[model samples]
Target: MLFLQNKKFSFSILFLLLLLTFQPLSSSQQLKKNVEFNTSKKDHCQKQISASLLFDITLHGFLLWASMGFLMPVGILVIRMSNREQCGRRLKFYFYIHTILQILSVLLVTAGAVMSIKKFNNAFNNNHQRIGIGLYGMIWLQALIGIVRPKRGSRTRSLWFFIHWMLGTAVSLLGVFNVYSGLFAYHEKTSRRIRIWTIIFTVEISLISFFYLFQDKLEYIQKQGVILGSDLVTSTDQGLSPNDKQKELPTDPC
Candidate 1:
């Protein structure tokens, strides 16, 4: 009977050891489950982050496009066409509209620049990023130029006009080109289609270019009209840029 009791005790000890060993197995299984759950959560968060990045990139492109591409060019168009208006409130009104449009453009571009700084890494390694940096400096320079503008008949007015027109033209062209590069970058990053957007933008730029050049050549197209380029240049207090209005004909002196 004593031997039987000893055997029972030994069996009990063995059972206890078995229980301890299986406890670790259960814990290890639970740990594996936890690890899988965490991994899935991490994957979900990464997807959300990627989606957010794409949206922000798209917004950046849009802001730049509106400011530099659309608004700036339209402003130039407004002022250019307004040179045809007789001196008075009509010209002043056009000027006001142009001023308003340009102000809005600057505001939009500033917002875009801020977004790029905050959201993007800004390595500036690519043409798009490099162009963007140039655009920022040029924009501020243009603003300074606008502020320190000379009086209408001042000697520096012509020089100022030249710089303003040339720089404005350059900004518009570069901005448009940068947007195209941006679209390319977006496609490379996201592997998404941008063909529709590219086509639409191309159409928009073509239309604006057509009107800009057509108006410029309208004087020459008017049935073999005689033009006196240099003599008619100083007709207004504000010197017309030879580049902008070289085709203006002389006023009939009766």
Candidate 2:
């Protein structure tokens, strides 16, 4: 009977030890699983948040670029071409079109600004944001300047024109640069492919530059032709005899 009791006690001790040894392993496994699940949940949440941010950023970025980068330059080009046309009616038509396009651009930019403010809660924190704010302010100021333009013959007209031209050119160039920066930011934030956008933007800028250069050369040629024609006419008149010159002169209607 003593031997049986001792054997039973030994078996009990072994059983307790086995339980003790396995209990910690089971708990540790459960804890590890819990931690992994929590980590996965966190990763999913982060992905969702980043996706939302990317959507808003891309939408507003496109709008901002369209308004300031694309439409503004096109408006300026239209007005420039109108000036070259030198026809009052055509000029007036294009002037109205330019104004309408610019107003549309301002509206688009305003919408984009609102979207950006809603998303970021602060402006001018980053380089892109700072440039965007400056561009917005300058655009509105340019519009005001257009509205308060001096009369064609006013003494201050030249000064106003100079200021307007310089300001407009600066705004356009800055806007282009800002768009590029915005694209980079978009790429960084979302890790989406930007090669296509970069290519498209490069093509657009190249076309615009080519058109500007061609137009400039064409204008220069036209001016030179006009000057040469006037010189030839003057020389021909000088070569004519006095009687021929008098005969060529317009007679007073009696």
Best candidate per TM-score, number? 1
Kindly list the per-residue Cα lDDT of model 1 for residues 11-34, writing each as its tens digit: 999999999999999999999999
RMSD in order of candidates: 11.6, 6.4
Model 1 ranges off by over 4 Å: 222-254
The models' CA-based lDDT, in order, is 0.89, 0.88
lDDT of 2: 0.88
Instruction: Point to the candidate with the largest lDDT.
Output: 1
**TM accuracy, model 2:** 0.70
- In model 1, the Cα lDDT at residue 153 comes to 86
Give the TM-score (vs. native) of candidate 1.
0.84
Per-model TM-score, in order, reads 0.84, 0.70
